[model samples]
Target: MNKEDLLKKYFRQSLSEEEEKEFTLLLESDHDFKALYEEYSNLNLAFKSHEAEELKAFLTSIDEQEGVKKIIWYKSSTFYYLVAAVLIIALCLPFLLKPSASSLYNEFYEVYPNVEQPVVRGSEETNTYNAFKAYEASNYSLATKAFEELLQTNSNPNYKFYFAMSLLNDGKFDQALNTLKDLEDLKFSYTDETLWYMSLILIKQEQPLKATSKLELLDKLGSSFKSKERKVLLQKLQDN
Candidate 1:
């Protein structure tokens, strides 16, 4: 294909794997193509700036013609600003709105820090307490090992939850999701929370459809603790 078509496909992320590889090779090796791409990038930015200025001028004209004197403060200037913001967002959507799964993960993922009381009352000696302490300190590797050792004999539901979180923090996404999958299936007290984390894992793995699916299930389950947050996340995924 021509440079124009290749660039268009690249921008749209519509190139096939092979085509993308070819494009990358050309971009790196061909000075002409590289310069063309840089030119295209600059032109893209310029076009966006020009369009934004035009949109702002149009909105300003409307506000001036309509006059803001009669409307309430809450409804007049606020409403017009809101309208302008929404229109600007809509106009810039194709270029500015990145709805990739990794973007979603970055926007939403947060580690569930240890909130458990030490299993042993005042001594910082026991394995369980040490595991909780490690987790609280964000020592995920130590926490994972300790949680794993504790679970070998205990099989405590809470232990599994913490283990999954530790694994997640350590970037063992698949293992963490496996443990969370078990928790979700059991419908345990932490099931909704499990689903929430599982969604985040899928998102980090670039599986937005799967992430959104899990979020939808969590929304249906409706945990009192996570209901509002879950709804907001679900809406965000759906909007994307």
Candidate 2:
């Protein structure tokens, strides 16, 4: 592959081991390529930030392409649209092929057969997840409505965490704190998430000692929570 392709692989987190090494070496030796990569990174970040239905439809089309080999073209009125979608998907394929929510849920929760099965199909879980996808894209307005609707019916911990985040991002500080406290009470697993968000809330409330206390609880749960984050929280608390 050319340096352009290798640089894209680096950005997409899809670089093969050899490609990564070469990309690093090139980064050490090249300036123009790095500048090009910075531009691509900015454009990709902007694409991710936009919350239009067209972008969502384009992503859905790419998701539909996962197992296909040859993509077909339609020579109809929508040909330009189809071509645009195809190129966007081709460009984003590497970055977009992340493991699914189920995979991430399993990895993080590691719930046992002996334990309660996740309410994956429940109306609450599904609605909360829909809100979370919006919240993940920083669309706080829609996320606020979705999460509030879920909160009215669901007391699920993971849902509450994301809901709290949706509220917090919108500067609804008191509501976020209340949600975090409720989630802390209901938490069965992912206590680190509970603690982490609680830390943020306490910090917002100007309660540094309480925030550090939350970080301490997070550390007790272990390092699925970033060690760096724990250290930084500690340092911040100390500085405060």
- Among the numbered candidates, top lDDT falls to 1
Q: Indicate the worst ten consecutive residues by lDDT in candidate 2.
A: 108-117
CA deviation > 4 Å runs, candidate 2: 1-129
C-alpha lDDT of candidate 1 relative to the true structure: 0.84
In order, the Cα lDDT scores of the candidates are 0.84, 0.67
Q: Write the per-residue lDDT of candidate 2 for residues 1-240, one digit (tens) a residue.
A: 897788778877999888888888777778987788788889887877775667888888887785342333344547778888999999978546744323322333311121222334544656756776567567877888987888789767666666766777777878878887876755466566666766766765667678778778777766466677578557745753
- Over 4 Å off in model 1, which ranges? 1-96, 119-121
lDDT tens readout by residue for model 1, 34-91: 9999999899889999999999999998997667554565477787898899999998
> lDDT (0-100) at residue 184 of candidate 1?
82
TM-score of 1: 0.56
Span of ten consecutive residues with least summed lDDT in model 1: 65-74
